[model samples]
Target: MVDDTSLTSLPKCCLSVVIPCFNEVERIQQCIDRVLEQPVVGEV
Candidate 1:
């Protein structure tokens, strides 16, 4: 079994979003802006 104390001792984690697009020039900026607004999203 896993220890709860060990989990609590771990450092905070950040998340990165990866978006793959081919021809999203018109909406890419909008997508990026929305992702940046997220509290846990560090990079897109």
Candidate 2:
């Protein structure tokens, strides 16, 4: 188990989100936008 404080202490934009979608032209942008909105999301 990991401590919550350890997770929160990390710098911003330290996380990268990966989304695998096939034939998702319409929803891909929306998904990417949401993922990028996160403070911890460095890249999508």
Residue-level error in angstroms, candidate 2, position 18:
2.2
Candidate 2 stretches with Cα past 4 Å from truth are 1-14
Cα lDDT tens digits for candidate 1, 1-42: 879999998898977677776799998899889898988776
lDDT of the candidates, in the order given: 0.82, 0.78
Clashes of each: 0, 0
| Model 1 lowest lDDT segment of ten | 13-22
User: Which pairs clash (backbone N, Cα, C closer than 3 Å) in model 1?
Assistant: none
For each candidate, give its TM-score against the true structure.
0.60, 0.56
**Highest lDDT scorer:** 1
User: Which 10 consecutive positions of candidate 2 have the poorest summed lDDT?
Assistant: 10-19
Off by over 4 Å in 1: 1-10
